[model samples]
Target chain A: MRVLGVDPGLTRCGVGVVEGVPGRPCTLVAYYVVHTDPEDELPLRLLHLDRSLTDLVAEHRPDAVAVERVFSQHNVRTVMGTAQASGIAVLAGARAGLPVQTYTPSEVKAAVTGSGQADKAQMTMMVTRLLRLPEPPRPADAADALALAICHVWRGGTRSKLAAAAERARGGRTR
Target chain B: MRVLGVDPGLTRCGVGVVEGVPGRPCTLVAYYVVHTDPEDELPLRLLHLDRSLTDLVAEHRPDAVAVERVFSQHNVRTVMGTAQASGIAVLAGARAGLPVQTYTPSEVKAAVTGSGQADKAQMTMMVTRLLRLPEPPRPADAADALALAICHVWRGGTRSKLAAAAERARGGRTR
Candidate 1:
């Protein structure tokens, strides 16, 4: 399965694409970050985000999209921007007619590093190893996007398999 | 000028359309609320919000769009939802190439009630009076939206006139 993962932000949004299915390793297709100027008007900035993401979706043509779910207890300064950026990501996916999946930070960390509380260094290392990268991706955001891509593949794969099995069972029996 | 004001929320989004210029009395064209099931998935709920808001914009063809700006130092449980909803509202406006304006709670209250700290009852009364409604709009969300519409008409009208004056001055300058 091909998946495009978005690490949403107002200033720096990370985009990563991964290709693979269950029982096999995934390869990173491309990873990059799109930046929007803080000085720009809010609507213009969001429009830039939407346009850039639409371009990215067109270029990658991934089968599905994964977005990092945003939650914060602190981050008073960043929370609103992050949440708004995330909404833009979801809207981009919806516009592209892709099934957008969201994974929490803990879920992504656990899926990649086998620990929900994995530190940034650990996450970087694990994501690098998973994709067999030459070096850890720069600026953590790209790595997080890769982790989101990885987590969604595994989790969504399981869900799809279960759904198929249930369909089969239902087909074999009376409704 | 016509303005469509959106009071954004995940569970209940309020929409109101008003028509008139700043000096003249603004009349309410329509007001309503769209509710999403709390049990619905986030993506689906957002799609509902987007679709409904898009239809509203299409129906009203407002000259501009207004959205309630979200802020939270407390109210943790609802902050993210509100921010996301507000983001969707702005996105809808941006998609339609409409100028999207935002107002804080205090700004709206001050614009409508001439008091930054007006209470909810006061807000309702002011919106009812401003709209020249037969009775106060049902539910606080709808009233809040009407208040937003009125605020934008008064505020945005001044901004547009200023912009026109600036353009005229620029046009007169030597190239």
Candidate 2:
């Protein structure tokens, strides 16, 4: 399966794509971060994000998309900005007809580092090891995005099974 | 003086330009909303926004930019999307070499309605009355954007003075 992982932010977004068959390890195909000039108008920044993401999708053509889910935070401004970025990712994936999935920070950590509370450095180290890369990914955001992709690959099947079970439970109740 | 007002959002951004003269009412020069297909990727959306805003700026040549300051709420997804959109607006204004100003929703409402808690309909009516438009501006976001421009025209100087004073106070304390 080919998977694209995203770490969404208002000012910058990290993206990574991996491709692999069912029995083999996924290999990194591409990765980059989209940045908006901090001083630019909000609309223009979003425009840059939109254009860059579309180009990435078209070029990479991943079969599935994975994104980080936004959780509640104390900083209202920060939370708001993160949410906006997440929305863009979702919209992009939906538009491309890719099956989009979301993972929490804890889930990503647990999957990548064998612990739900793995720090950034640990996550980064684990991602490099898992991907069998000669060097770690540059820019912390990009590393986090790669780890998120790994998490999706590891947990995606279980997640689908749980979702199916929940759906069946609801259906049974209705009938 | 000319002011461009922007209401930034994920799918659409509303823009309005007004020319301000000392001791005279601001004149509406142009107004329009830019939109992106939700199905497109983030990069494509950003490109559409960038092209449209660049064109608008080149055509109208506003001297300054006024944008709404987003306040975060419960919806994490929505807030992040808005922030990305806001970033686009900021980048566009900076590219045009315009000094960008931001107004809180309360400030815009207060400037137009003499009440900070004014509803959208109330604010829209006031904006239409102030601009002497034949009808209310189409799209509530557009009207809110115009209100932001008007707010800047009415209170920008005072706000700047307050900001300067606050800066001076910080400088004195540091010394």
Candidate 3:
């Protein structure tokens, strides 16, 4: 399955696309950061993000989209902008009829580095190893997006298997 | 000038359109709430809001859009959704090339009821009186939206005058 992961922000949004399935190494399709001018008005900045994300979804055509769930526990000043950017990312995926999922930072870290409390360096290292890249993805935001995509692919695979098992246990009934 | 006011929420987004200038009673053009199923997924809900808001902007064609500024100081559980909805509202106005302004709840209250700390009941009463409505607008959300619109009109008028004065002070040279 192909997946698009978004690390949302107002000034710089990270986007990564990967292709893979369960129990298989994911292939990096593309990764980039979407940046908006901080000097621009809020509405215009949001509009720019909305358009960029919409274009990314169209260009990638991922089966599913994964976004980093924003929390207020971080910097209070930027949390709102993060949340707003995430909403735009989710909207872009949904508008294209793709399933969108959100994962917490810990969840992505756990999925990528085998520890929920892993530090940024560990996350980057693990992502580099997992994706078989010769070098780590530059900029923490891009690496975080790649990690989220990897997490979704692995977790989504397990979830589908569990659902299939439940279906079989229920005498193959359609649910 | 006409303004479209949005009190952003996920489940029930309130929208109000009003026409007026500073120092005059505003007339309510329309008011309604856009509802999205709470059971729906986050992305779908956001998409629904985006479409609704875009349509509203197109239909109303307001000179400006006024949205309630969402703050994280409110209910933590709903703050993210409110922020997301507010982002969508801002995007709609910006996409249509209309000036969008956000007003705090206190600012709206002060503009409409002459008190920043005015309670909701007072707000509703003043909104009714200011709009010359025979009855109070139902669902506090709608009233809040109208209040925002009224505040934007008055504040925007003042802002323009101040800008003009500043320009005159600068020998009427465009900065």
Q: What lDDT is reached at residue B166 by model 3?
A: 87
Clashing pairs in 3: none
Task: Answer with 1 or 3, whichever has the higher DockQ.
Answer: 3
Model 2 gets an lDDT of: 0.76
DockQ versus reference, model 2: 0.18
Candidates by DockQ, descending order: 3, 1, 2
**Where in model 2 is the C-alpha error above 4 Å?**
A1-77, A81-122, A133-142, A148-175, B37-43, B74-77, B157-175
Regions of candidate 1 where Cα sits further than 4 Å from its true position? A160-175, B160-175
Model 3 interface CAPRI class: medium
What is the C-alpha lDDT profile of model 2 across B1-175, one tens digit per residue? 7778998886879998887753357788778888888876565575567668778888888877787877775255666557657766766776676667778889889987999999989999988988889999999888988888888877873564566598788883221
**Alpha carbon RMSD to native, model 3:** 4.0
lDDT of each: 0.85, 0.76, 0.89
Q: Write down the TM-score of every candidate.
A: 0.91, 0.63, 0.91
| lDDT (tens digit, per residue) of candidate 3 on A22-99 | 768999999999998887779879988988989989998998899999987778888889989998898988889887
What digit string (tens of lDDT, one per residue) describes model 3 on residues B28-95?
A: 99998999888777987998898989998899899889999988887898899999999989998988
TM match of model 2 to true structure: 0.63
Q: What is the TM-score of chain B in candidate 1?
A: 0.92
Expressed as tens digits, the lDDT of each residue in B1-175 for candidate 1 is 8999999998999999999888667898999898988976676678889899989999899988989988866478988888888888998888898878889989999989999999999999998888888999988999999888888899866785687589788884221
Q: What fnat does each of the candidate structures reach? A: 0.44, 0.29, 0.86
lDDT of 1: 0.85
